[model samples]
Target: MKKLVLSLFIVLFVFGTSLSQIRPVYAAENDFTFTVGSNGATVTDYKGTDLNVVIPAAYAGTTVTEIGRSAFDTYGTGKPKITSVVIPSSVKVIQTYGFRYTSLTSIDLPDSLLTIGSSAFENNPLTYVEFPDSVTMIGNYSFYMNNLTSIKLSENLKTINGGAFDTNHITKLVIPAGVTKVDSSSFYNNNLTSITVLGNATTFGTGVFAGNPGNLKIFGIANSPVYAYASSNGHTFVDGTVLFQAVVSAKSLLNSHLAGTGVGQVPANTYNDLSAAYHAAMIFVDGIGNATIASDLDNAAIPLTSAISAFNAEIIKAGNPAALVAAITAAQQAMTNHPQGVNVGQTSAANRSTLQNAITAAQQIFNQAGQYLQGELDVAVAQLEMAIDTFEDVIITAGNPTALGAAITAAQQALTDHPAGVNVGQASVGTRTALQTASNAAQQILDNAGNYTQDQLDAAVNQLNTAVQVFNAAVIQAGIPTALGAAISVAQQALTDHPEGTDVGQASAGTRTALQTASNSAQQILDNASNYTQNQLD
Candidate 1:
């Protein structure tokens, strides 16, 4: 019996030693249920009713290194009413579903956090989130179904799993240069308008931004993976480097002007508008404020450039009045050179009036106190110069009246020699009348010789000379008596052939009587040539 007791004692002692070496599956300390590992403790569950939970950095004498899967989830045993959480810096990893389906509106992610497991903070009411630079990986659906409108991703992030930020209110996002892989549907079904990917080597999975805005702009390097992905998915891709350059250029353009009313300065209102646009663009350049998107930068740059252009246009420039003043002086000198008068060899009153009007307008423009546009002054100068040239074209010169006076004298002598009557060698009444009319017109031109031009006086002289030649050609001559006697004989014979009362085809009784009477009168005139005039005999 004493040998059996000794063996049982040995077995019991061995069992106690084994139990002492083994670690507990979970140990409850304060409100946390954690598991101790070789490295540190991991919070496995929370059994608290606190609305604000602060996970201890050290639990059960070991540093808490992680938050275990489903530790504070809706399905967890405690189901605490957590609205906010303060994670300790001792935490490095948050396992899958660590804080899923919680009422968390705010959470402080510690800088020491390295990995976020799948659906770790899913179905929360988080409106904003910022991952620390130490975080490298984000698991699937990690921040799904949240109220987040903006998020700042960790610079060291390398991977983003499927549906990690799906179904949120995020409008803008920036994927840092260290990011390598973004899984399918990683940012799906959100309100994203702009996303900037800084890395050129990052690869994208299918539907990464599916169901987001159709006008979503993705910014990246020109030929990088993000650019390719955006092209294949029908999203607009903007080059971030180019956008930044544009912003810088716009800022530089705006700063080149000063705000004042002095020369070479822009108006105060114009400068203010440009300054506002520049400052707004700087927000995107510096990656702060709500203007953190690529579209924001684009929108800001356009207005800034427009404002700069407007400012430049409104700048007060000093206009040189020397050219305009010289033009005015030259125009006035032209007016003095061509005086207004109706006398011979002088400029017409109408031309002088036009020149004076042009000079008046130009002088008015030059009198303005340095507020006129150069174009306006140039137009005035052109008009005044044209007026001066036109005035010179209309000057009247002296015309000779001696030729017209001689023509009138010769025509009058012809009328005196060929008097209108029946006398032999005298002009016919019609020819004398023509010569008299032409002589009267030429005499009137000679009386006011200075009023008519040289061409007009020459035309009058030619007309009077033609009339005199016609009068002399049509004068009564010595052979008229013989011609009249022959004509009377012929008429008498015509009367004898067609007698009165006979129905001959040539003449009736009245026509025969008239011919006999005319023949008798011609015979009487031809016989008594001393008493009858040439017109009467004919």
Candidate 2:
């Protein structure tokens, strides 16, 4: 009887412990049903009416670390009304069918998530999904039969099981560098346009990209395993290395010449050319995994490299715009110095307009970056200098007109003092006419100062002054006999006083000879009085 009692007790204890181990410890918190485990709690089910649910990170003082199978799936009692769900960061694993056959249009996967069980999100209306870097394993048909148009796989993801992303609308894919294996039919039966494999040694199972487009492009390094696979599988293969290098070189060139107003800056035309080539190359680079042919990439790479080389060569031949820029600055300063207006000492409006035009043209040339030719820049500088000179001359002549006015006044006064006539003491008609003509011309110039240049005004002033001097010299003063006339009168008096015959109280033979000689000399001088002045006679 004692042995039987001991065996029964032992069986009961064993049975009790097994039952305890098998039966989950259930708890409820915030509309979540959790099964407590050794490490933490697992969310088993949600009994809520909210369309957008947020699973708690902890329940009953235990961290929720896992999502149990069929936790929100379309089982006997389904929660198909949930359109979106927010999984907490504490949850690392989602077991099979955790959210399968639900109305989940979107699901927020945390970065702490590690494993996604088979069919975890199968047959839903999801349009987009992205796996976090912490996720490594993706079970078969994990996102199968969905409306996923785009999916971003984790960079750290290693295994993509069969049918993991099958029967979706994925058009392009970039396999991460860390991915090692893609299982059979991993991305099958979709509208895939291209796939870029970053790793050269990544293995692909059969039918990994089956039922995609026939002309689908596979981009990778030249002669890589992915390339060989693409060739053997009757798919188009493109080597992206050359194009990538071309892009890098183009970017480097662009960065090196980004300064707008300094040494080594690129010309606008050349910079625009480089920009066009770089953009074209980027188009191919951006389309590496999508519809980009190898020949097209090759074409773009050659031009892109050529563009970079061309920019470098252009830099070597870039002309200096500093001279032109300085000239423009000087021209502007001159314009400021001689402002346009009708006031005295100010530049005329017309001259200022011309100078401003020239300055504008020069400025345009200066803004041509380093592309302007030396000849063109020199021409611009010359034109601006000419304009400045002209402007200053006008300001000096037309702007002030003081010298011209004074000259005209002096000439008029001389005319008033010396009237024109053929009389003995009056000015000669010819000299008076000449003086009047010069004075009239000068007066006209002074009256219309804006119409004449500084040179014209100066010439007029000089001519008028010369006329006045000539008129003054030509005039004979009253009672002041002409030099030849005075000499004749003295000679006549001597001749009358001293006769040539021998007479008492008369001059001797030598005196008579001297008087005759003096009269003859005076006669000669009187005959040519037109050539002698009063001072010469005296």
Strongest candidate by TM-score: 2
On the 0 to 100 scale, the lDDT of residue 479 in model 2 is 34
lDDT of 2 by residue, 431-536 (tens): 8788889888878878888866666677777888888888888887533336557667877787687676667657777876777787787677567555445554
- Tell me the spans in candidate 2 whose CA falls farther than 4 Å from its real position: 1-30, 242-289, 295-538
- Per-residue alpha-carbon lDDT of candidate 1 for residues 1-538, written as tens digits (9 for 90 to 100): 9999999999999999999998523323477888999979999988877666778889768999999999889854558657777788979999999999899888889999999999999999999988999999999999999898888888789999999999998887877767899999999999987887766788999999999877787877778898899899998877665554454455555556578765567778887887787677555543633334555555656766676678768877766778778877887777676577755556877888888888888788788826565666677778887887787778776589999988888888878877887666687778888889889988988999987878878888888888888888787765447779889888987877767665545677688878888888877778787555555656
Off by over 4 Å in 1: 1-29, 76-78, 242-538
* lDDT of candidate model 2 versus the reference: 0.79
Q: Which candidate's lDDT is highest?
A: 1
What TM-score should be assigned to candidate 2?
0.43
Q: Which whole-number lDDT from 0 to 100 does residue 382 have in model 2?
A: 81
Instruction: Work out the TM-score per prediction.
Output: 0.42, 0.43
- Among residues 3 or more apart in sequence or in different chains, the pairs in candidate 2 whose N, CA or C atoms overlap within 3 Å are none
